[model samples]
Target: MPNKKNFFLTCAVLAVTLTAGCSSGADAETSEAGVDSVAESVGDAKGGSSKSPADSDTGRPRIRLDTTQFEEIRMYQGYLRCLKDHGVPISVKGNKMPEADPGTLWFPNIDVAEERPEVEKACLGKKPLHPPELDPQKNPDYMDDYSKWIACDNRRGLKVDPLPDGGGWNYKPGVTQPRNADQIDKECMIEAFGGE
Candidate 1:
């Protein structure tokens, strides 16, 4: 029997090369697509590292996520790192993201977002890092908490409001000069990052 690992590798390589070969004409096949095209459509979540998904510019395609390759990528540190390396933006259904890649926050269109000097500068060309393993997204309480935080961050012009200078539990705004992490509430970072 063929080695399973080698089999998958061969499949991926053939897919990439064939894709490149077919598109050399610069005309994307407009017909209905298969799994390869589906990867192209998902915006190539290959953002954690340098390698981009094939045909990233092609219109977005819906991903089944049930595929073996996707399952591997979802669990692969290197793949998530590639997403960050390439500056591909990631956006999750909620803030829930891969625990293995902490620094890799979810934002849409990572490729474009990476072009922004800020992210490029922030990443410092270093290997992508996943955020700390957060509370389980599957938990009902965490889901509720996630929604609350999302809503709170959605509140326009959310300023950092820490204790002693503002409301106890309720954050007060208009506190000129938002200070560092030590001076702000824990929620400030989440808010500043747009609740990502």
Candidate 2:
């Protein structure tokens, strides 16, 4: 039950880490083009926020929408299907999305550089949008919201120790994470970050 945000962050971090090892010759341009396409679509949306910060690399404004777990799963499944359809050799089993875990959807042997263009094409509009309020660059109140999330986690038996100066937090050193850590994270995230 890890929150959608955490799951998305985990997947993004994993993707970046894995892709960093591959050669970045033409893939970089392809990836940027995909990002630009998403930015255009988001910027064109009706009633979208005008306060989105511009990306440093592309100089395009980033427009992100708050999304729920179900929405994210649906989008991810579609992207996976698209990849399969585009001959990326990924297997999409059933309709259910995989659990939000690091190794769950990981394909270690996949040649990211070779497949990157196809991935970009398939996932053009399928990237999970970040909520602006949760983005530190966009929201002045990010630290406050993060602190609330930390407090919520602690109250729920996660025992997180927040770093000083609005830095991030880590689990209390000796305390092992509970078996239901994901559930706690999910509930606390909703409590701290979800708009009422």
Q: What is the model-wide C-alpha lDDT for candidate 1?
A: 0.29
lDDT of each: 0.29, 0.44
Stretches off by above 4 angstroms in model 2 are 1-8, 11-71, 86-89, 93-118, 161-170
Candidate 1 regions with alpha-carbon error over 4 angstroms: 1-137, 143-173, 182-196
TM-score of each: 0.20, 0.49
Candidate 2 is scored at a TM of 0.49
* Number of the top-ranking candidate, with TM-score as the measure: 2
lDDT per residue for candidate 1 within 146-172, as digits (tens), equals: 344434433433332322311112234
True-vs-predicted CA distance for residue 97, candidate 1, Å: 23
Cα lDDT tens digits for candidate 2, 67-181: 3333333334443444555666664323333444332232223544355765654354534344455567777777777788788888888777766654445567688767666
Residue 20 CA error for candidate 2 (Å)?
A: 25
Q: Look at candidate 2 and give me any clashing residue pairs.
A: none
